[model samples]
Target: MMRRVRAKKFLGQHFLEDLGIARRITESLSIPPSHVVEVGPGMGVLTQFLVQREDLDLYLVEIDSESVEYLHQHYPQLSNRIIEGDFLKFDFNKIFPDKFSIIGNFPYNISSQIFFKVFDNRNHVDKVVGMVQREVGRRIASGPGSKEYGILSVLLQSYYTIEYLMTVDEHVFSPPPKVKSGVIRLVRNEVDKLPCDERLFVKVVKAAFQHRRKTMRNSLKYVEFDHGAIMHLPVFDLRPEQMSVEAFQELTKLIEEHPLCE
Candidate 1:
């Protein structure tokens, strides 16, 4: 018989006990047969359903040694697929030579960091389905002109289409988290290349939202730009929250064309 595995506080382990939600999350992945990496599969609640899909080449990345050992004993068939390491630091290029989808009941503490890594590897990652802190999920899937819209909204929206899937109550987990949870899906768009400087686009979006209340003209003062020229541009008058992903791309182009002197 399998012994009960304790949740590790430092690791942010809140194992999902609800099978219905687990099945729903597993079915959220729309990608065809390919590599699939599940992060922090604590106690293998969702893993059980994921492994059922023979089309997917399932792999689990768990940081907790105890949980990893438990998975090894329970799912002996996944001996080579179960990777024991930090998902943030693990090199995906080494594991998958091509694209893959990421799914999990992600750790609430490092949820944002996981998305950042996903964004960084956007080229090799086509789809992502995961559960995160409610606010974080809403923030990522939020569009322009909303209070939740910010850096992540713009950055992620640029390359991927985000969908706020479902809300999960705190009662679903073994040790209920203080806040509610949400599931989100991110599907990569077909933009082969960005119209403007991609790096500068990120910088501009972050700078503008640094003070979300301020208009683009005032918020982007720290960034190198010709204030006089850009002041007349319509985008400069609007707040960061008012601009869409396309608008931000346009703003970056304008700044690059007419740069300010130090």
Candidate 2:
């Protein structure tokens, strides 16, 4: 029997309780020997299923000190894999640094930020599978022209083949969330076809979505000072939301060549 841990609203704790769901989440990873990292292993509910796979190099990261202590006492074999810190602030390069896969029933509050973190380190991650709010999952998997489609969709799509794996009903979670949840799998693009500085790419994507209703010309203002070269872009009159991921890439290239910064 699993020991109960008090749900902390401040931490956004909604522990997954369904055993079948836990197994399904584990199976989704297609775990190979020496390949697994789970974030926010609350109560070791999912951890119980994950560590059983001898092939998996299961590791857990928990931020709640009490929960970490609880995990330590309950699962001594997993102690080496346990790291106590905010997964967002934890250095990916320092953790597995090289390429590895990650799984979790992530805290919904910082789920989007987690996506950004993974995007920033796409090169280091082989694949990422996690359950986040269903609405967020839709946004990440959203296509161009959908209301849900914006910077995140475009930015992530540029580097990954995102799949909307499955949706879990609210009942699956203990002290269930008001919203439905979903599982998403992101596999990093092996081809490095995007042609702009990673930093500038982020800047361009954020600027476009910052003023989603604005045209390319107006959006460029968020990132550019002088409009000399920016105005010359072929799609300057197009709204940022109307532009495709490729267009954003082209615009970033233009920004680089004419450097409004320099």
Candidate 3:
């Protein structure tokens, strides 16, 4: 028998009790999984569907001891698959020797952090299907010139082709979040390596977006590059919000080839 576990506010726990949504979320994983890891499987609402798939070597990582115990008690079939630890700090390389997909009704507070971890391990993580705050989903999948477009927009879109799958109603969760949720799918693109320095590309994108109101020429002035040469480029005339991922890549190359000092 399953036992009731209170959602911890500190952890931003909002259990998805709606089985229909759970089924949809699970079915969204189209990959023939060698391995899969579900983050924060609170109360096993989504786990119930994931464990049914014989193809996937499914694993659950939950932080709450009470919820972990409940999962073990209720879903004995999971057996040793349930890991009690922080998903952000867990060593995924040790778990899945090769590639794997990540899925979850992610904790809203740490959703961005979770994505940053995913970005760091993009080579091995081929696909990601997860729920996040609608605003975040829009921001990630937003394109150039959109007000929603910002840091996550350029960074994640640089390597992955993102799709905003659907909007989930707030009432579906046990303790419904104030904002509606959105499901998004991220598929890795064919670009193995970037045209410019990866570190410098990130720095440029972050610096460009720091002051959205300013033009790239003004916003990127402090980025340790040749202002005189960069100022001549037509791209500088555009605001950070107006620049595409490809445009940023080009800017990175410009900075690399034409350093004012050194």
Steric collisions counted per model: 0, 0, 0
Best-first order by TM-score: 1, 3, 2
Worst 10 residues of 2 by lDDT: 221-230
Record all residue pairs in model 3 with backbone atoms less than 3 Å apart, i.e. clashing.
Answer: none
Give lDDT tens digits, candidate 2, residues 164-218: 9899999878889999999999888876758877688888888878888888788
The C-alpha lDDT values of all candidates are 0.92, 0.83, 0.89
**Model 1 agreement with the true structure over 139-200: per-residue lDDT tens digits:** 99999879999898888888899999999999999899999999999999998678999999
What digit string (tens of lDDT, one per residue) describes model 3 on residues 75-166?
89887899998999989988788889999989898999999888889888888999999999999999998999998889899889999999
Ordered from best to worst lDDT, the candidate numbers read: 1, 3, 2
- Give per-residue lDDT, candidate 2, residue 96: 70
Q: Estimate each model's TM-score.
A: 0.97, 0.92, 0.97
The lDDT of model 3 is: 0.89
- Per-residue error (Å), model 1, residue 108: 0.3
Output the better candidate (2/3) by TM-score: 3
**Residue 210, candidate 2: how far off, in angstroms?**
0.5
